[model samples]
Structures are given as C-alpha cells and as structure tokens.
Target: MSELRFEDVTVRYGTGRRAMKAVDGVSLTVPTGQVVGLVGESGSGKSTLARAAVGLAPIAAGRVLLDGRDVRHRPARGSGRAVQMVFQDPYACLDPRMSVGDSVAEAIPRTGTAARRAEVTRLFGLVGLDAAHISSRPSELSGGQCQRVALARALAARPQIVVADEITSALDVSVQGTVLNLVRDLQQQTRLGMLFISHNLAVVRYVSDIIAVMYLGRIVECGPAHEVLTDPQHPYTRELLAAAPHRDGYAANSAHEESGAVLDTEPPDPHHLPAGCRFHPRCPVGPLALPARTDCLSLDPAVGAVGRRHATACHFAAPLPTPSHQAT
Candidate 1:
C-alpha cells in the first residue's frame, strides 16, 4: 500500500461569497521508501497540500488516506507519529529558550532517565550533530545545525514519512548541500518515505524519484524525475525548466532573448484566478495571439494519458519546435 494518498482532495478556504479552493481535485499517491518532489511556483498549493497531508490543514472534500484509511474521518492522532513535518524555517520552528536536546527529545517521550539520555545522544549522532551541542540553545547553532536539529526532531518519533517543505531554501549554498546530503543519508539509513516540496527544479531533479508539477492549484504534469526534467511535455513545465539557471552558457540569439516572449508576466493572484488553464496567461508559446487566444483558452486542454511514465495537462502536448534554454 502507498504510505500516503490524496484521493481527489480539495481544500477550500473561506465561505459562500469568497470561498476559494486552494487545492482543487488533486490526487496523489506517495509510495513507501521513496522521495516525491512537489514542484511549483509560490501559491501553487504545494504547501497547502503538504499541510493537509500531515493533518495541519483541513480538507474540504475527498479523503486523505494513510495506508488506505481516511485520516480526516478517523482523525489519525497517534498515527501522526508515523508522518511528521520538517518545516522550511528551522529557527522559527525551534524555541529560542529550549535546549536543543529538550526539543529533539520532545518528539518521543521515554520512561527511564537513562534511556531518554541515550536516545537524545543517538538522535544527535544520527543527524550529524555533536553530542555536546545538546545543551545549547537555538541561537548557539548555525542555520545548518538548527536544520539538522529540526530533522532530528522529525525523526524522533520514528516517522515512516516526512513532509519537507523547502527545508534547504533558507540556508546558504554550502550549508544547503550538507543538509540535503544529511537528509538523503538519513533516508537511506531509515528507508523513510518523503514528500519534498520546492521551487528549484535542479534540486528536485537530484533527489526525487518522481516529480509532480503544479500550476494554479492543479497538477499540470507528473512523471519520473529524469524524464520530466530532461524532456518536459507541458508548456509550463518546459518554461520552468528553460528559465531555470543552468551551468551551460547561453548563445546570443537564444530562447531567453526572444523579444515578444512572455517570460516576465506576473503570476496571477490566487484569490482572483484567471479562467482556463491557470498557466495560460504566462505561457510563452501558444497557437494564437494573447489575451484572447480562443483556441489556447479552450475549456478542457488535452492532458495526455498517464502512460509512458509521464502525464501532462496541455491541449498540445507536442514537443517544442524551437529549443528551450540550454542545459547547464
């Protein structure tokens, strides 16, 4: 069975006149012992979905299943121990006054004093922290160390799955690598399931077994990490990858330099979303002209079948005629 599953889940905020569905008819299955990357721009409902999966956000419709049981109906309180969250900001997550040891130990309560002490020491070691750092406060540690402490706290409950929401975005590049490696190592050691949410497609490619792309509260594409990254079928997916910073040098007359290309349009406000595909407004290439692209703004764009290990929500899933930005 999948570790966690969202069956046609919908989370609507507000009521009556202003009710808005942050996650609209979204369904996903995260298998055990694998990392699933949820990639999208801000306000794409990634974090909202993450919160609902972990019981932090309430679901307005559909079932949030854990091992095939509805968590919303059953209220998986103790079962939450098996599914924990490592938030994006570690410093804000931790208490300034509490000792790092106390914070980590708070996840799992132990009976005997000796056993508790040993558990704390083991967890510290597990997250690559010095045992001596246990007594220190949050202010005493660097951003990376604090994040490690956060990971240790999440694992303290012996969770089978962790929802990591951009955990490395706040850290420096050097420190981000350490934290990413640590999470990967810890996952290998524990064989834990993970739902990793991020905007960075490069980082998503590195760690995800599967990638799910989101646009305006809907999953626009889903596929294997390498396949989706290397050859994206959706226009939004292709645009995202093209815009991503790469290691390779760009030629003078490149896709990025096209004058009329819609690379700089602002994302639509989530409260007042546009019609048709949420990404249509910002989509660089379309069959017709902008603003009133009748064919492009058709009711139901053709989303390819969930075969070939890739599914894309585009009326035209055809390959791009012109080359996208060069691969770094």
Candidate 2:
C-alpha cells in the first residue's frame, strides 16, 4: 500500500500581490516499507515537500494523503505524531536539559510508570543504545548518538513513516554510517516507510529505493533510485549527476558555480513565473524538435517518457555524448 501520496500539491508564501509559489503541482507516491529520497539544492522545494508531508507546512492547494487519510482532515499535530520527523540537526531537535529517556518517554501519553519504563528501555535497545544510558542528556552524547536518540523518539510513537531531513549531514563520515545502518536495521524490523530529504546524491543512493528530483518548485524527475541515477533522463538530473563528487567517479563541478558560464542565470521570480517548462532558462542542450516558448523569453524543448519507468521534463530529453574533459 502507498504510505503517502501528494496530488498536485502547492505551497505558496505571502499573500495577494506578494504571494509566491514554493511548490508547484508536485505529485508523488511513497509506497509502504520503501525509502524515497527527495533531492535538490537549497530553495529547490525539497524541504518544503518534507514539511508538507508531515503537516509542518500549510498547503495552499491540492491534497496530501497519509496512509490514505487526508492530513488536512486531522489536526496537524496529531497527524504529525503518526508521522515523526528527525531534523537535520540532532542537537537542535533534542531538549538540552531533558534526560534522553525523559525526552523519548514524552512521546507516550499518560501511560503507567511500568509501561513507560519498558517502552523507553525497549526503544533504546531498538535504536542500538543501551537502557543504562537513558539518564544521559543530549550534551552527553556524540552527534551519531543524538541522531539515534532522535530516531528513538520517532520510533517511540510507533509511526508508519519517518521524515528524515538530512539527518546525517552534521555527523562525521564514520558516525554517519553508523546512524544510517541503525536506520536501515529499524526499517527492516518495522517495515516503516521513509522520506529521506537531502541534496547529497551519494547518501540518497545508499538509502533510497526511489528518488524524486526537484527543481525551483517542481518535481522534474522521479523513478527507481538506480534507474534515475544511472540512466538519468532529465537535463537537471544530468547536471546534478555531473556535479556530484562520487568516490569512484571523476570529480564534478556545477556549471552554475563556474565562472563565465552563460547558464548561470538567476532563477525566475516565483510571482512572475516564466511560461512553458520551468528549466528552459538553464538547459544546455536542445537539438530535437520540441515545444516553443513564446509566452516566456526562454526557449522550450521536447520532453517525453523514455520508458515505462523513466520520464524527463527537459525538451531535449535524449542522451548526449559525454564531454571530453570530464571523461578522465
């Protein structure tokens, strides 16, 4: 079953003349027990989608369904309790003064003393922490331990899904691996679904079964993780892949970050959105016959479904030869 589904969801900030769309017509389905990664650079609406899924962000238009229930029909806090989130910073998320056990035990409502004790202890073990360390505060633990505690709190609620927004970015590389392994172990045991949001493609590749690539405020591409990463169809995905610095691959730098690149134009104002495809302003290739962009100033290209499991939004979705300099 699908744990969550977003249909034409849109989130706008401000009002009247100043209103701007932060998420535009984004639709996605996250199946139960699957880890879906929402990846994009800052201001690309990845975090906005994460917040909307957990009821932290108000939706201006469209529907967000959680386990088949309309989240808007329920209280945001109550609905959120069913779908917990582990923020990017574990230290910031935890109560500095509260004991780790107390913080985790807080998730349960008015349960008996014995039940709460058993629950907290069980959760500690479940997250790879011992029950003896329950008395420790957030300050006493390492970054990885704090993240594990954060996961423990989320697990305490017995949630169906976990919204992990770049949870490992702050930890040391070795520590990050430990926390990630714990997450995978917990997911395997509970079959809990996850929405792993981050800009790091390597981390997403490690944890996600499916990947959804976002642009300014739209999902430009989405598919099975391996399919999307290895056989990217969208120009934006290609750009991201080329920019990612993988261990076994040649290092890459973003075209936008390079000096003297004509494609480094600033994004279009959300209020004054460009017509046709949103990515046309920075697209690097367009040989195939495609859409014309008359309404807006940017040229439009052809976009099509390459296969049943693959789709791209770029007008020139066909594969292009790799650049010579990058082939080292």
| C-alpha positional error of residue 77 in candidate 2 after TM-score superposition, expressed in Å | 10
Which runs of model 2 end up more than 4 angstroms from their true locations? 75-80, 248-265, 286-309, 318-328
Candidate 2 all-Cα RMSD: 6.9
lDDT score, candidate 1: 0.78
lDDT: which candidate is best?
Answer: 1
Each prediction's number of clashing residue pairs: 3, 2
The TM-score that candidate 1 achieves is: 0.87
Top TM-score: which candidate number? 1
TM-score of each: 0.87, 0.83
Q: In candidate 2, which residue pairs clash?
A: 301-315, 302-315
Give per-residue CA lDDT, model 2, range 175-282, as digits (tens). Answer: 988887887778788888899888988777778899988888888778898777777777667777777767745233233233223246677676877666676666
True-vs-predicted CA distance for residue 117, candidate 2, Å: 1.2
* Residues 30-85, model 1: lDDT tens digits: 88888899998888899999999878888888887878777555434443276789
